[model samples]
Target: MTPTAPDRLVLVGGTIHDPATGRDGVIDDIWIEGGSIVARPTDPSSFRQIDCRGLVVMPGGVDLHSHVVGPKVGFGRRVAPHLARSPGKPAAVPTIHATGAAYAALGYTTVFDAAIATSAAALAHLELADLPILDKGIYLLAADDVAVLNALDRGDACETERLVSDAVRAGRGWAVKVANPGGAVFWRKGRGDHHDLDAAIPGHDLTPRRLLERLADAVQAIRLPHPLHVHTANLGLPGNWRTLLETMRSLDGRRAHLAHVQFHSYSGGDLDEGSFGSGVAPLVEFFNAHDSLTLDVGQILFGETVAMTGDSAAAEHLAHTTGVPWVSHDLHLSGGCGVLPIAYKEKSLIHAWQWAIGLEWFLCATDPWRVALTTDHPNGAHFTAYPHLMALLGDAAFRRAAFDRIHPAVRKRSPLKDLDREYSLQELCIVTRAAPARIAGLPQKGHLGPTADADLTLYRPDRDLARMFSVPAKVFKRGVLVAEDGHVRATPTGGTLAAS
Candidate 1:
């Protein structure tokens, strides 16, 4: 169904918190006309007005990374049937319709599925089309194609750029993603564990390091709105922060995005318990010094969630260690993904450490604009977990109480105990809405400026930050009321946003 805008709408007397536009809690009136924020109409009676006194307004939320659809998500839904039906449990993998309604009700208006294989672009789009009330797109797994890898191997940089461009255009992709680059070659050869950023592919001379650098260059050369989206090698392993640092250094100041960075920043070596701690300090230092890099902290909130990714090796390692029922599929030579259910326990040592690491990155990062908030959705926790995570970040006492509940050893070793920085409303706005949209290259999103998309959320201000964000008073998508008070009111069809 086509999404039609209301004739005219006015949100009067709300404190607007559009950080991108530098309007920090300014009590103002917003005018909407023909699906876009516009100047106030000459005749005040021409617009239908909504009373927003004492309300806080901002642009609709934008989630930069999530696993919302496609074959891997389907696999997760199939494997975890109980998640969808359990009385007290939120589904680990929700149905397409539920994903749309959940995000809309949460006041989000834009989302990007972080990894979609180039070969399955059509299937992913079909699933995304059913996702209503938000503009959506996918990052193509362009580096998984052997032809593209071969181009990199032969030093045919120009041809490689062409292949990357052609794939993005053909797939209608928003960005290029390299998930554990060259790890597939290792996986197929039964040595997936041996491959690192510097390790060579089985039959090709191309290394994951070079794969990252070259792909990043191609993405910049294409001048796409977003840079290359990278899920670097050595995710979820002990002492993998070095790999992350190396991945960063290889770019040599070229722009790239590191996905699920929390998983990569661990201090331990050789999977040992004593060594497992927060590696975020050094990583955060490197991150702070580099302006060309951006990341989404795939925070791990303690609960049951599905871990799915194009990085089959990481999944394989996780499945082996946790002894969970896991699923993997190789799409010929294109690439593959893995899915498994994981439950993080507060008393468990590693889980506690992981929880601390994620928060450490969030608190330590100097710039909110460069680090967006994500639970990696269903991977770290559910997208619904955002409210709870926000509460943890915005309320220092809440974070301390939760930290004290975790494993005792984690309290002694982790850096979270010493951190007291609490995020302000403006900084929270930057991380959740403004930063993500800007990182995803959606210019018209994440702000309520004139001529921007009229996707806005209005909230009744409360001292509880989580409550303030969780149940918005009203949500408008493209100038149409889509949700109110934590319920989806309109199931309007959403359009696909792609880069050509």
Candidate 2:
């Protein structure tokens, strides 16, 4: 399904919020031609003009980190069939068609599946073909390959770089991702407690730190648009903040993107519930001082959702603790992934802290451009819950009201209670659009600047931030009207963005 050429048009009199071009809420006209934003023509009568008076316009949304496709996602849908049975609503892990329709209706035009094994990339791409309306890409889990790991173990930097580069090219991936480096190897050998980054993998000379450093160097050498996408060791474990910090420090000034830092930022040791608390302060302090690092807060909203990850050890631990039915698969020596249903309750001490810790990361951070907003998709909450999360960030009063309902101990101990920072719409645009596009190396997708892809959304202003963001009044994908008033008007075949 090839996309037809888009018409030349002018969107007139809209309040634009393109952070990339620094057009912050300015009333202006946007010109589009051949699916890209263009300079106004000298013969203005040749273009079709659409009146956009009283509407707020911004570039389409880009989700830098998410798990919207793959075998793990398929298992997520199977494990929770009831989540999809609700009529007129999307499942937490939606069908391929529903995933794109839901995203487009929410004004998103670009998304990347955060983790896909090199072995599974072809299947994922096939699934992505049926996913319409948003341009998509995947980060290949290249480090999981036994050959690549052997190269790292032998300290063959050239071989390591060549293998990673080959994997990215062969898989048609947008970037390289490492999930709990050496985690699957340990899991296969039934040694799941190797949380120390310096500990050597069984039968391998390389430590997690070395594996991470070598991979980060390879990603840089390959010159892919995004840096190494990392899901560090000891995720969802007590006192994992130390591991997260060590992982960042191990980079040694090399660039890397941390996935779902909220899961890593936690205090306490050995499941001591009383000592468990927010460890965001130290992590945030280090992150603020380092420009080489960027992260997404996998913010957990209280509700039922599925947790899926490339870290089988973390998923197994979670399943064991909850005693819930879970699905885990080993992609023969390449990697493994786990999927299970999860429920975050307000009264649960751990869940409450998770909620607060995520907000703490958001409030403590100084730069919106270095941060991306994600729920880890169904892992934290459904992508549809994004508008609700936006409201929490933009409305201090709303945030406080929700904060008061969580566990009393978390309220007493968490710093979120004292924080009053609220994200302005301009900043919101940066995190959701401009920053993600810049970080993901999709220069043309996130902004409405001249020569950029004509992916933009318009909303009717409302005092309620969530309501205003939940459904855009109009959505344009590559200058074609794809959705309007929460319904998809056109099903254009969106292209797959990949690194050469």
Candidate 3:
């Protein structure tokens, strides 16, 4: 069924916090017409007015990175059936139906699955079609194609650009993504020793660095809204911070987005337990200085969540280390992914440091425009943890108490012990809605400026940021009231937001 526009509605007398327009906490009425925000209509009787005198209004949230659909997510659900049958509620990997309802209830109107192999684009889109109330798109795993690598290896930049453009167009994809570029060659060969970003592809001349440079160039040349989304090589390895730094440098001012960066920012080498700690300082400094890079910190909250990624080697390492039931599958020559359940314990040094380093990245970064808030969904933690993560970022006292409970060694060595920055409400808005929408190339979805989509969240302000954000008083999706007070009022089929 085709989606129809809602009746004219007016959210009256709300304290609007539209960061895009610099309307900070100003009391104003917002008008909606034909599924888009508009100027006040002339005929007052045509509108249904909702009194929002004490409510706080902002653009509906945008999740820039998540693993909400496709084969790997399905595998996660099948492998851990008990995960969805937890005593209190369902699993971390929610079904397609529940995922949409859950996100809408939390006030997010848009979400992008960060990695989808080109081969699985059809399957993923089928699943995404079932996702309700949120506009969705996927970043095609273009760089994982053998032909794409061969083009780069042969120094055919034009061919590489054409291949990327054609793949995205055919797949109806939103952007290009390269997960552990050239790492697939090593993984197929079972060469665990070739974990370095500089290492050459086993059968080709292309290295991960070269692959990134060429792919980044292609993404820009094609004039795609998003830069190439990269899950850099050496993910989850000790002393991988150097690898991440090198990966950023390889872009050489070309725009590219680094995904799930917390997993790639560890300080240790050789997987030694003692050598691991916060390695975010140097990376954060370089990231702040480099204007071309944008990232999402996959913040880990204490709990059980599935770790799933297209980096097969990293997934294998994690599965082996945890000695847990895991699954990995090859997608012909377009790379692969692995999934395993992980429990982050405050008493575990590595897990505690992971929690701290993610915060360190959030606190130390100088610009909110270049950063996005995410858990890489089900990787670092579930997307539902966003409210808790926001609380940790907004309240220093709450953060310190959580910090004190973590492993003692991490408390001593991690830089989070001294960082005093607490994100203001406006800043949190940027990371969650504004910056992500901008980064994802969706100009109309992130703000309440006239001509933007009528997707908004209204909350009754409270001292507790988590409680305030966890249950929005009202949510509007394209001018329709889809959710109210944490319950689904209407289930509208969201559009598949792919590039033409």
Task: Using TM-score, rank the candidates from best to worst.
Answer: 2, 1, 3
lDDT (10s digit) by residue, model 2, range 43-142: 8898999999999999999999999888889999999888777676578899899899999999999999998989999989999999998999999999
TM-score per candidate: 0.98, 0.98, 0.97
lDDT winner, 2 or 3:
2
Overall lDDT per candidate, in order of appearance = 0.88, 0.92, 0.88
Assess candidate 3 and give its TM-score to the true structure.
Answer: 0.97
User: In candidate 3, how many Å is residue 358 off?
Assistant: 0.2
Off by over 4 Å in 1: 1-4, 192-195, 270-273, 331-333
Q: In candidate 2, residue 246 scores what lDDT?
A: 95
Report the C-alpha displacement of residue 148, candidate 1, in angstroms.
Answer: 0.3
Candidate 3 stretches with Cα past 4 Å from truth are 1-4, 42-45, 270-274, 331-333
Instruction: Return the candidate ranking by lDDT, descending.
Output: 2, 1, 3
Given candidate 1, what's the lDDT at residue 134?
82
